[model samples]
Target: MLRHQMTIVSETLMPADTAPSAAAVRSRVTVPLRFPDGYTATAEVLTFHGLADGKEHLLLALGAWEQALLDPEKLDPALPDAGPLVRLHSECLTGDVFGSQRCDCGPQLREAVEKISATGGFLLYLRQEGRGIGLYSKLDAYALQDTGLDTYEANVALGHGEDERDYTAAAQMLGALGATTVRLLTNNPDKAAQLTALGIGVTEQVPTEVHLSPANHAYLAAKRDHTAHTLDLAQPAVPSHDEMLARVDALIPRLRERAEETERIRRIPESTMEDLREAGVFRVLSPKAVGGFGMGVETYVEVVRRLGRGCPSTAWTVGHLIEHVWMLARWPRKVQDEVFADGAEPLAAATGAPVGQATKVPGGYSISGRWTFASGVMHSEWVLLAVQHGDVRLQCLVPISDVELLDVWHTAGLRGTGSNDVRAEELFVPAYRTLDWALLGAADNPGSRIHPDPIIHTPMATLLNLVAPAAALGAAEHAVEMFRERVLVRRVKNTLEDRQADSPLAQARFSHAYGLVATARLQWEEAIRVVTASYQRRPMTMTDHERAAYRLSLGLSGTASAEAVRVIMAGSGGSAHRLSNPLQRIQRDVDVLLNHPTLTLDPILEQAGRGLLGLGITVPSF
Candidate 1:
């Protein structure tokens, strides 16, 4: 059914103008193709003419591919089978041909061929190399990347759009082949959006497996952050920790820039929330079954710590929201299913002060309360509100729609957290959606039984206490860095020393601050190791002494972190104390964050002293 086009590039092999008035497609050749890895697929390679690009683009129709176009034009996703699972794979010369580890392009190509062959579809290989920026420019961008710029940043640095792809030709080719509706096999949202915009019906967006390697981690992260790509680096997929860190690292610069804006708005802006969601920050504690990363407690602390270096308010809110996922997991499986039916998604905030009261009903509880510190509520889909039910406290999970959000948070430090008041009036929460406070922190909780992942078995009470200190640690680190940079350039005002870098006092301050950061880091790591090690054991155990010790770690770390920031700020001179200076902000944030009960040194030391004397912990409920 192939036809010839009238347009000729050079001299026509057989001029369509002279002989044939035919279709745009001139050839459909079946070829048996084998790869070096012994993977084989019979490809019906196709060629088309009069393409808008005037390039010889390729199309390979895979297994039962004929059956795909054989169907009626419309796609019924509810049907047992629906496809032409098509992938409009853009060309990548270095990745596809030379086995470049810099990007996931090669793996994606190999995966697409095998997957499409199994289910039936077409792989349209468009010759838009480097995301339509050509090969030479892509390599040039790689050169820029060596200088520490991200892929997108490098592209912009090189006077090009972050992604210059245009899928108009892809749509035309699909239309020419009569594929009106297709299940798009792509991770890139732009691909689907562009195709849809160009009159092709995208029936479903089927995500691609994250083909993450050490070298391509940042490459994949850039795609996720710049464009909304569906890359869930869940377990057995990619090494989750490194991938998650890479994503967070990509966000730091942006977060630092938005620190002032975050404070001004008294909340994390909606865009920042999207950035966090895109970065997969909120999925660290959700179950893998629901498309979550299901990362461990130590990983959680590390992420929060990194986030603090950017914006402590954001870090504080995100930390609380992340912990809520674990809390959700502790509920009954039926409830967990309802909460996660969509996906392991963003911003589930919880306020745990028993400010709300719940009355036991026949099948549920009628709850009412004005809860404080409902962090991240602006971005939350669900809110876990702690309510007193008779003698015990119950965590009642309610949809965010049920609660009335009150914007009342005004503070000197961590102002962007928007830890506002949220009120629920006579809301009915089903019993299944509730978990007793006693069970939540227990190592042998329902989440452990329901989902036997080691993380599920974590003693969440301690984990909750420790999250704030991570932010403090990170802010302290940020302060150290900021002070270091300032020291090199700052002039010692009214002094003979040319710069602060030359002053002995400045040098001593820098050294002292650096040592405190190290101390804070050591303590944070030591404290968090307890969390990581707890999950690994079958029946995770932390004696009252151990719990006391954990608190001591947090207290010590928080103190060191706060002290580090103060030392840096003091030595940074009068300019450093200004409202405009980030150093002062860091000092304020670090100091305020350390005031949390878990980090307050007096009680922590007292508890540790008791533990050392074989005196039991005051709060030994877990």
Candidate 2:
């Protein structure tokens, strides 16, 4: 279904003789309507005079619908002051009366009545049977439908327009009832569009529940594909892309205020973690099967980048935590069920480079190793450790209680990451909880088959490339903003200029800084393009060339973004480096981000050079 945040259509002229007034309302009679499902309501059935379509259209006002009418001066209600909820339901006899399962019309009508009754509104039952093709033609169309033609195509085959129902009567009925504005309950855009076009003020278009059935799956699918209905037939629905970003953007101020405390304590505060949870930051990339948004890597990158502007440490920790949800999705189905049982959204932190050892046991393996730099481990309930079991390298999922933390995370930057070392001494890991490290590149892995989202097939190398760079880019962007602000106030001590903003050097530095930030974002977008394009086509394991492309583009994004921060730091006055200033923290955080094993310059450069020269890549994880 099509959703617009707000759609305001200009009111137009109607036939002067038939325009709504006291005469538009002909009569009203009280009636009690009940359904076989035990739902009951008292409705005031009303007849209208001079409607465009002379057919006997009836309007049933339920609940406090009469009390909701305004004084004709108020066009819209604000916030909690909601306008009447209305439904323009065209006549459907087969489904609504005979309980046919071939279409969702019956359930939709039931839902609309209940919802409208609860919110106080009128149900305008227009006599446009079979989408205005009449009952006989509708039955003929149904015959065509039995031959595999969809709802719309069957109508066309029967020599009728696809959908002939019009909403002129609906708008007229609302006008007669003094409901100029309404919260429309519908999944059909046509109702909203026609009503708007006919001078009805639609304050909001609220979608009705999707009444799907195994018998009518194809019918719903046709309606969704052909007419663009808002139906998530594949998986559970997630918020729209813009809505998700808005949720993250809304948290920026809070994150910025807490950045100091986060770094001072060397970990994210509990309150801050709750804020992230409320913002849905940690589930941005988790599997939809387990109640996650199941978003793609591109969305994940953009989310990480935006989060960094609030606080680099918070963004870094949250970014890893979000990616771990994606990592957990790649595990076997049994492990996924165990971890996500009882509606628990698991927060996991993983470390793989400093490999551990796993000895094969009866049903699993005994793993032992000290993995360093487990970012966000302090908040995580599970730790994914990379271990060598015999000749095969495996990723073992262990509970946080199975490990001992070594507080050795003192660093030059990103101090809030709390990337301490975790030692797991001779701990038993079930076979179901372990996956072969080599399968990280497989497109048809266990998770891919289990989760409908294709991002579950993303390679670890590709994710590693995107994760840190996204946060680095966000910090660099903040650096440029802070530098621009400082350039306005800082005056040259020895020079005659009143402010540094008047100096040619300041202008040059700001211009260069802005250009570097733009370049870094463009570079990062290239890696995103590569990752998103492949996922759309089909999830495929990245070839060496693809990894090299990602390595160069994303690696350069981090490097370029770091240079942007460096330029900002150099141009910013001495006072800018103080602990109180966020600019210095941003620089230090980005510096440590560049030192990540994946973002390090030497391997990235070598991988790019090899790909350019048509040589094999030496670094498999590049």
Top TM-score prediction, candidate number: 1
TM-score quality measure for candidate 1: 0.68
TM of each candidate vs. truth: 0.68, 0.64
Candidate 2 segments whose C-alpha is farther than 4 A from its true place: 1-236
In the range 1-622, model 2's lDDT, one tens digit per residue, is 0001111111233434434332266788999988866799889898977777788999998877755543212432353335588888888899889878788888888888888777678888889989899999999988998898998999999889999987777777777655667778888888888777666667788988877644567788888999987777663468777888998898888888988888998999897887777667777888877767888776788889999998889889998888887888887889888887633258888998599999989999998888999998999989999999778988989989889989999988889989999998889998888899888546767888798876787666667667788999999988888787777987779888898889998899899989999999998898888777666665455656766787788889999999999888888878778999898899899999999876788878887889867798876666
User: In candidate 1, what are the lDDT values of residues 221-242, reduced to their tens digit?
Assistant: 7888778788865434424788
Candidate 2's error at 467, in angstroms?
1.2
Error of 2 at 416 (Å): 0.9
In model 1, pairs of residues that clash are none
Please give the lDDT score at residue 259 for candidate 2.
87
